[model samples]
Target: MTPKAILLHLRLPFSLFLMPVYWFSISQSPHFDVTKACWVFVIWHVLVYPASNAYNSYFDKDEGSIGGLEKPPAVDKELFTVAWAMDILAIVLSYFFVGAVFALAVLVYGLVSKSYSHTSIRLKKYPLLSWFIVGLFQGFFVYLSTQQAVLHPYNSLTNNLLPAILSSMMLWAVYPMTQIYQHEEDAKRGDRTLSLLLGIRGTFFFTASIYSLTALCFWVYLPLQQFLLFIVLTSPTLVFFLNWFRKTWLDASQANFKNTMWLNLLASFGLNALFITLLILQK
Candidate 1:
């Protein structure tokens, strides 16, 4: 109920984890209204993502570590209040500034994120279902939303399917990694994350397989030089992931918060770097 707990539970830092989707979405537009893009950024990162984090925290009330928070605060009613406040603000902002299509997208995204953690229909309990949903909404849905926000005459997904699909794949890569370190907490909450079902080694194998295929698709989709630059930009993430994978292969215990956070942050950074470069180059 305290201000500190409420603020920490908001998990605004975790918004960085999802920023690549927004960046990649805009990068595809070639040209966009900068003011609209900035508003979309504030709507998604400042309001929607933090609200989702707080809402999920309110429901889970985790005693152990969760993504972006190694020592989570005790969730209270105030957290729930703050989450709704933010969600309303996001929706209102989208409605006024971003347009109806984007506003509706925000509404749906918020509701779906709420459903992910709500007891009424906690989607997190179903490993594959939850995994797919996270990838779909956070990935494809976000790409769509970003396009809605920035494009003057929004382009249809029919044309931009590859990057939109890749956005989901990027999130799919992130989803399991976030759960790998939360096995006990997730299990305690009766949530069977894809990571738990795969087992520690299996989780890494599955992630590597998915990431490999995703990267191959990106390579095929991007121009030769762009893809090469992508590899260079993302090399640090790939290197760290491989090193972490090797360590976790030797000892599952290595898949702890410190390692998982580094993976998430580094991966986000690398992807953000690549997409932002593409965005700049497009201009």
Candidate 2:
């Protein structure tokens, strides 16, 4: 495979969509070492997430638009090689530069990601199961791991389960919307994605409900002033989502890639800004 093709297959830009999780993880950690946090970011955003994308691309090799690429480049065996190398590098770096707990987190996340697309143990084929685990892996698991990797919180888990669960809730809410535009392609490929199971309209309802619940949880958890600030900060994304949902409800065709990508961009920007503000305020 050419360098360009392999790089594109890595879908590095797609990793931006996952950044809110990184920021969420860091902000929630009880302790923050800038060095450890930076390495954690590098391990996940630079190596782990892209490797996951590459591995999946090696197997799927989609001709149509994938997550980041509008026209995806073809994949080959070397793609898997690159992915494996990245995963190995990430784990090794985590162990050396970060900590053993961080290293183990990288290992577990890598294995689970490999299973998602590997033909022998393809979790992507099961709609509900895949949906459940992807949310858990990318969200709650990420939050907890990031906290441990950076902060080594003596009580990594119970100290703040509701927030960790909120992370998962946010992911669970948005997971299917990413697939809403690809229902036909996934169906033809025999992949029963969460969006396919939900159907276009049901997907909208599900995303809105879960997202709203998460927001409400934040409302209850945060002080009145902080929650009000959140709503204010999140207005742009909220308005866009409601508008998009209304349009999609009228015509599922509105759920096309262009609109979907816009939503992803807006949501990522809003969430990142929100948490960064929170982090700064905490500091």
Candidate 3:
């Protein structure tokens, strides 16, 4: 594939949104090997995530806006080769840095991600299944994988489970909303996306409800300082969400690519900052 196509397909900038998950996992772990953690981060964001993005872009060949890109380039024949190569590299690196179990988890994540966009299985076609798979793998699985990598040879599943679950719940709450602006495009491809099934208003309400539960869980589970920090860091997104929701409610056209991108940027950057601060404080 051409460099431009590859870059666009990789959607590298979008990985910023996912890095917070890994950061959160690392922050929660009692053991932190900076070297191993860095390797894991690179493996996930550079190889694994890009592979998934390339695979999906190759299959979708989306002409309109997709996540991260307003105007995606045409897919190239070599994109598939690059994607598979990255997947293999990610698995190999995972095996060496962590162990068999961690590598297997990475392998499974890669397979699941491929299936989500692969035409044969096309897990994306099923709304509930799609939502669950994306949230579970991207949130819970990634969190666990990062924790495993950071704390290799240590058993702390009990300690780590709650944060992972909370991360997954947060992802589930936001995942469908990501598809809100893509209803027409998704429908055109005969993909009944979760957002389409929920409708615009329903998507917002569903997200709000899930987020409320997630907040409640955090309040009950997380330490007071951490919970307060979470609220403080996430407040901007809350403000933007309310403003965007109101605008969309007043004029559905406001929920287009531009506004959606603003939402993504605001949320991703805000969370990234939060997690990075947490990591620093933990250190």
Best by lDDT: 1
Model 1 ranges with Cα > 4 A deviation: none
lDDT of 2 by residue, 195-280 (tens): 99989889988988988998999898777887887788778878888899899888888998888888888888888887887788
Model 3 ranges with Cα > 4 A deviation? none
The Cα RMSD of model 2 versus the native structure comes to 1.4
Query: What value does the lDDT take at residue 200 in candidate 3?
Result: 93
TM-score of 3: 0.96
Q: Which rank order by lDDT, best down to worst?
A: 1, 3, 2
Ranking by TM-score: 1, 3, 2
- Tens-place lDDT digits, model 3, residues 1-283: 6798788889998887777788788877766788888888899999899889998999988999998888988887799889999999989988997677779988999999999988999998999999998999999999998887778466668877888998899789888878989999999999988889999989889998998998899899878998898899889888998998999999998878887777777777877887778788877
Question: Model 1: per-residue lDDT, tens digit, 1-283?
Answer: 8888888888889999999999999999856889889999999999999999999999999998888999997877888889999999998999898788889999999999999999999999999999999999999999987987888787876988999999999888768988998999898879998999998888888888899989999999999999998899888988999999999888888999999999989988888999999998998
Candidate 1, residue 219: how far the Cα is off, in Å: 0.8
User: 226, model 2: CA deviation in Å?
Assistant: 2.2
Worst 10 residues of 2 by lDDT: 151-160
